[model samples]
Target chain A: MIRFEEVNFAYGARSVLRSVSLSVGFHERVAVLGGSGEGKTTILKLILGLIRPDTGSIIIDGDDITRRSESELRETRMKFSIVFQEGALFDSLDVKENVAFCLREYTDMSEDEINARVRHILASVGVEQALELMPEELSGGMHRRVSIARSLALDTPRMFLYDEPTTGLDPVNADNICGLIAELSKNGKGFIMVTHKVSDALKVADRFIFLRNGSLLFDGNRHELLNSDHPDIMIFINEVCIQGPSGA
Target chain B: MDVKRTISDLQDFYSLSLHGLLGIAGRPFYFKDALLQMDYAGAGSVVIVVIVDLFVGMALSLQLAAELSSLGLKMYIGMIVGISVVRELGPVVTALVFTGRVGAGMASELGSMALGHQVDTIRVFGLDPVKKLVTPRIVSSLIMLPALTVIGVAVSLLGGYYIAVFVSHQSGTVYWTSIRNILTVENVLAGASKPFIFAYLISSICCYMGLSTRGGSVGLRQATTRAVVMSIVMIIVADFVLTRMLLYVLGFSV
Candidate 1:
């Protein structure tokens, strides 16, 4: 399980996360929902050991990753994969190379083995046809899928961290991403997504967390989230679901 | 107003610079990246160097020929071209060219990465940005600049020779003999020394400017421009300082 205890992060004098505590059990598909700049990405970065909490601890799978050495952190990182908002694939490398990057860096696997594994992951993400394509050539949705394929190449019991997976996609492509998240969750990967999309969250998130003012305002199952008497939750749902007269 | 804070900032800057240096030690030595950087620095600057060197060499030969002809010593044209090209023009021109091409390119690319959060991505991956990005560039520039300066010296002399022999119609044999006589160990050593120092200055300044960039696209542009200008200025200043020091040590009049 991934756990945060009394986490507090501040940028200069301004506090971002204050005494925030949260946890995700093994095989849990948790959606952290919050509006923009509410420390959603900060939580993910802390989990990834990208940044340290000012005064707290982050423990993952029995290991306190917060203070691990760089090599140790890299070893731990192999257990998880992140799909950044913009995909973050190296522009000079093609889809195949991008997927095989970690493998090439950390493993002594032969070219044939790397190629086979890359092909398998690409096929799994439904981006096998884009193996030869550059990042600039891929659509936004396709780029995200390619990033997923790259993440899956390690094939560990991965924790897939997505930051606004559906931000720039059309509704159809957004639905496709939701479906992909659902499929990954069904496959038993620990999928933690940060999003404001109620429909997407409801479709794939088994557990929901609403963060407000740097603290967890709500943490419950999807059914509980949909059936809650909370006014804030209701407002969030309305904002995501309710369209204008002509459909926004 | 805040002396302690100022001291702390200075301390942090030194620590960061040391961190950057140590970080550079961990990257895989990429020969391909080195070759690409060299090509960008050296091959791309050939045309400009050739054009400028041709005019400079021709003008120097013309002035020297006119002065020496009055004393019936016109054959010393080759000596003049040889000493100037080997000891000063070659290294300085190569550095100026590198400042324009590779220094600006490094600053802009690294600055973009700083702005785009790619450097953060690298850090998260347990990779030091300095190691992965800056080290290979620094090492490559250090190695390649001297090699490029040699090429520059050759080209400049050839341009000078062509102007002296064909354009000016000075005796080819006399010109060649004068060059052979005047070419000394100090001249070659001095010429070779300049580029290594210039490479370090240019690469470090560019990398420093790049990593220090804040804001976004506008900030990156400013860093690139600053890197080029700083590198050029530093190279010129260093040239004067190094020349004086070298001449003093060699018992030569400055």
Candidate 2:
């Protein structure tokens, strides 16, 4: 489980997250929805220990991680994998090498075993043919898929973090990615996906979290989220309703 | 520049350099990466170092020989050119050139990685970016810069030989003998030591700049420029301090 207690964060003088408190279960599928600069992504970065909270405690599996050193944070980070907004694939590495990187570094798997695992992971993400292709050759959707494959390469992570995974894709591709995320969320694998798109979030997440102006506006199931008369939630839902599901 | 910010940055740069130095003896050594970087920092630099030093040597010989011949000391051309190149010019020039090429490349590459979140990704994978990226670079620069300086000195002497024997009409044997005689232990040691320090400063500063990059392309440009400019300035400054310190250590007067 991951929990953030009264977490606050700022970049220089500009506050990005303010006194936010939340908890996520080991098998929960959650989507954190917010518009641009609403601190949705900051939550993911904080949880990953890439950045620390200005105040408050972030506990992973009951261990407070706010004061952990970087080398120490590596242990906490190993429990989760993240897909960055821009894919963030190593440009110099081919798809196969990118997926195999963690395994090669952390595991003592033989070459054949590593190759087989890489192929299986890539195939699971529907990009098996891209094994030899560099990141520059991939489309935005394919790049995200490859990034997902790389993240999934390590089997030990209990949760996954997705940052605006479908923000830039075309409507059809976005739908396909949403479908992929939903499919991957099965078998008790939990994920916290942060995005600005309500439609995409609804497809993959059973629980919805609304962040607005650097604070938690709402956190509940789909039914509570849909029925809530909260002005910001209503505005987000109304925008999605008027613009249709893609919200593109 | 804000004084506090500058001081903070220096502190961070020193910390990073120390971390990279310690990583050299740590486990999971990236020998292949270091070898590749050596190829990039060393072998790739040969032609440029040779070309630039060759011209510098030729010009120094032409001017020094002309002045010396007027006083019947033209035969000492090799001693002057050799000692100057070996003791001062070669290492400083090579380090400045290296800062422009290798240091700038390191900053841009790592800056792009930071912007792309690749560094964070490495951290997420339980790997240290300083160990994986900075250590190999520091090792390569530490080894390659000195080797390149030696090459620089050799070509410079060759260029001086061309000017002294061909243009100035000095005896080739006398010029060679003079060069051979003047390269004392202290002179060679002083010249050879500067590149190692310059290499460490260049690699560490550039890596730090690259990893600290923020914003976007504009930030990358700023970091790259800072890496090159700061490296060059530091190299020049270090050269002066090192020369003086080495002379003192070697029991030289003044």
Highest DockQ: which candidate? 2
Give interface RMSD for all predictions: 2.4, 0.6
- How does each model score on lDDT? 0.79, 0.92
Question: Given candidate 1, what's the lDDT at residue A229?
Answer: 76
Q: Candidate 2, residues A1-248: lDDT per residue as tens digits? A: 89999999999889999999999997999999988998999999999899999999999999999999988998889999999999989997999999999998989999999999999999998999999999999999999999999999988898889999998899878888888888887978899999988888888888999999899999999879878898888988886787675422
TM-score of candidate 1 restricted to chain B?
0.86
Question: Which tens-of-lDDT digit does each residue in B124-229 have in candidate 1?
Answer: 5546566677776777788777777777777777777887888778988887787787677777777788998898888878887887788878898899998899
What is candidate 1's lDDT per residue for A1-248, written digit by digit as tens?
89999999987787888888888986888888988878888888888887788998999988998788665787666566788878887776799998988787667899999999999988987889999999899999999899878777666636788888898999888888888877887777778898877677777777999988888889998668877778878887776556421111
**Which clashing pairs does model 2 show?**
none
lDDT of model 2 at residue B172? 97
Residue A29 displacement in candidate 1 (angstroms): 1.5
Question: Model 2 misses residue A40 by how many Å?
Answer: 0.7
Model 2 achieves a DockQ score of: 0.84
Ten-residue stretch with the least lDDT total in model 1 chain A: A239-248
